[model samples]
Target: MDLHYEVLGQGKPIVMIHGGGADSRDWPYLAPLLAKHYKVITFDSRGCGQSPSQTEAANYIMDVLNLLNHLSIEKTVIIGHSIGGQIATEFALSYPQYLQELVLVAPALAGFVHSLDLLESFQAIQSAAPDVSKMTELVVNSPFCSVIKDSTHSKLMRVMTEHNIRKMFEWAAFGAVWPKPPAIERLHEISTRTLFIRGTRDHEDSVKIETHFRAVPNIQFVAVAGGDHMLNLTHPEELYMNIVTFLGEPNKQA
Candidate 1:
């Protein structure tokens, strides 16, 4: 599927991918900071924001590659959040030639066994299908909001939640159809410079996934103090600084 994307500035390219229930807008506070040093691209993944709904699951990886191909970006830095981070990991594994560097913010890895409570929460949300108001409420109260200390950031998240609730539910329902192999064992295969960032207060599953990458030689992990799953929104400055520093390193580029 052709994605809705925006390209800004010039120099080494940086592609930003948002997590589930979000779109390109998630980078408004950070993209510009990075754009000052490199060309930056942000887009709505398939079935989110302005992008069209998708029938097939796990097509996000390809959709991102296709977007790069469409823009003639052969090699660039890739930054992904949550599920977007999962796609970036898959992309690095599948097409290492196209990456310059990788930054995963609270990325969700494939094959990491989720806790029963987490699974149950998801099932509960799924079972409450078509209840947009309830879903919106649940999302607003989710761990995604834990680190949103700023009122402005809180409002922004709420707005995004309202806008994407229906589509979020739709995407969640398609999850059962796209089971992927575990990526933990393949981390060593990724030679690209990769940085993993997670919040101190983020979900347990997200925090725990970092442990699996401890043995991966090319990965660097950092924890944001007092941050949450929505660190990009709640702590954009710190996130932006870490990204700029990582990408700016002379020897880090692939």
Candidate 2:
């Protein structure tokens, strides 16, 4: 209930979870478009944007469930990007009855081991520590994110990354809590229809993640040409279209 959330046009509910180092601000171009068709809910996950930093171990999956309960949303479609996608995946596996559909964009897997290159890049940023400027630069220039470098939204991406990085300093040392065994081990357990989307210009790891998602019973894959990990910001229209088709919803001009 303490999370900062926004609600858009009314219809079947659609929860939008932004990626790590990002908040709902990434959806300015996509939410309204999706809102035209269904009620869109966007929120700042704990320790990001306006959401409060956690003193206790963070359970992102529970945070999501609490948000849905607080809003009285019993069942809804979930659209998550990057780390957000990981959370959505676990939630769908743990509480399949609460989901109608799922959409993942350049998602990080729950149990899959990420590349050493990625782990080192993340560590480098953290090593920069309280040097907010250096952390922001490292993140913006990181391979998984370099796709945003030339876009007009690069400044926006930088600002959001900086905001989330600064908030990290306020969080406790406690690590985030995820479901047991992890979603990667249970991809076959997913019951809702799923749409997996990754950009052509994204990192090599994203390409690898796609191969793992083949276990899902009802799922579709999309490769966005020229899109990157930040597709929510750079390719909202494309994301929206793919989501519409996957959900079997009418394609509005949005």
Candidate 3:
């Protein structure tokens, strides 16, 4: 299925993929900042936003390939967040020749899964027949406690709950199948220049991702101080600057 995506600014391409339960709009704050230096593209993965869903389970690798093929993009940089980051890592592993650079934000990787609350939550969703509504609430509320900062936490929680509940449920169900991608053994195999970003205050998995990719010769890790998993939304300008620096591009023109 052809996914719906928005393109902004003009320059080398940088595709932004959102996490599960999130649409292209998840990058609204981040995309515009990057658009200043590179052509920024954000898309809703299949089964969410304006895209039509295929019967196949929502596989991150499939979505990445399809999006690249759909855009006829032979080469580009990719900035993936959360589950989207998992997809990006797989894509880089499978198609290293096509990537110019990779930026993983709060990426989920092998052994990054938490045992307590996070796994239990996902397990509950996976074992059951899928309750889109409950999952929606769960996802929206999951990050609130981690935000640390009161105002940002409250605002994001409200936005996620009120504006994208139904879409969130659909995304939750789509993501219910399969475990997060494994990148531990494959990190060294990835030749593409990579940058991994994590919020210092994010869940344990976020820090684990940083440590996982640290051994890779081509990867760099940047921790967003006082930031949460929602760094793209919470610190768009700074995130964009770091991405541009990794790509060896000039900062966006003010």
Best prediction by lDDT: 2
Q: Judge candidate 3 at residue 170 and give its lDDT.
A: 48
Residue-pair clashes per candidate: 0, 0, 0
Which TM-score value belongs to model 1? 0.90
Clashes, model 2:
0
Q: Give each model a TM-score.
A: 0.90, 0.96, 0.83
The candidate maximizing TM-score is 2
Q: Positional deviation of 78 in candidate 1, in angstroms?
A: 0.5
Candidate 1 pairs with clashing backbones = none
lDDT of 3 by residue, 59-103 (tens): 667667777888788899998888788778878888887898889
**Candidates 1 and 3: which is better by TM-score?**
1
Better of 2 and 3 by lDDT: 2
* lDDT: the better of candidates 1 and 2: 2
Sorted by TM-score (best first), the order is: 2, 1, 3
lDDT of 3 at 48: 66
Residue lDDT tens for model 1, 1-254:
36788998878889999987788878888898887778899999877788777666647777878988988989999999988898888888888999989999999887778888777766776677688767666666665556673446877776776677767655633542222455777877887989999989988888689988775678888898988888888788899888878777523432
lDDT of 2 by residue, 18-63 (tens): 9998898979899999898899999999888999998888899999
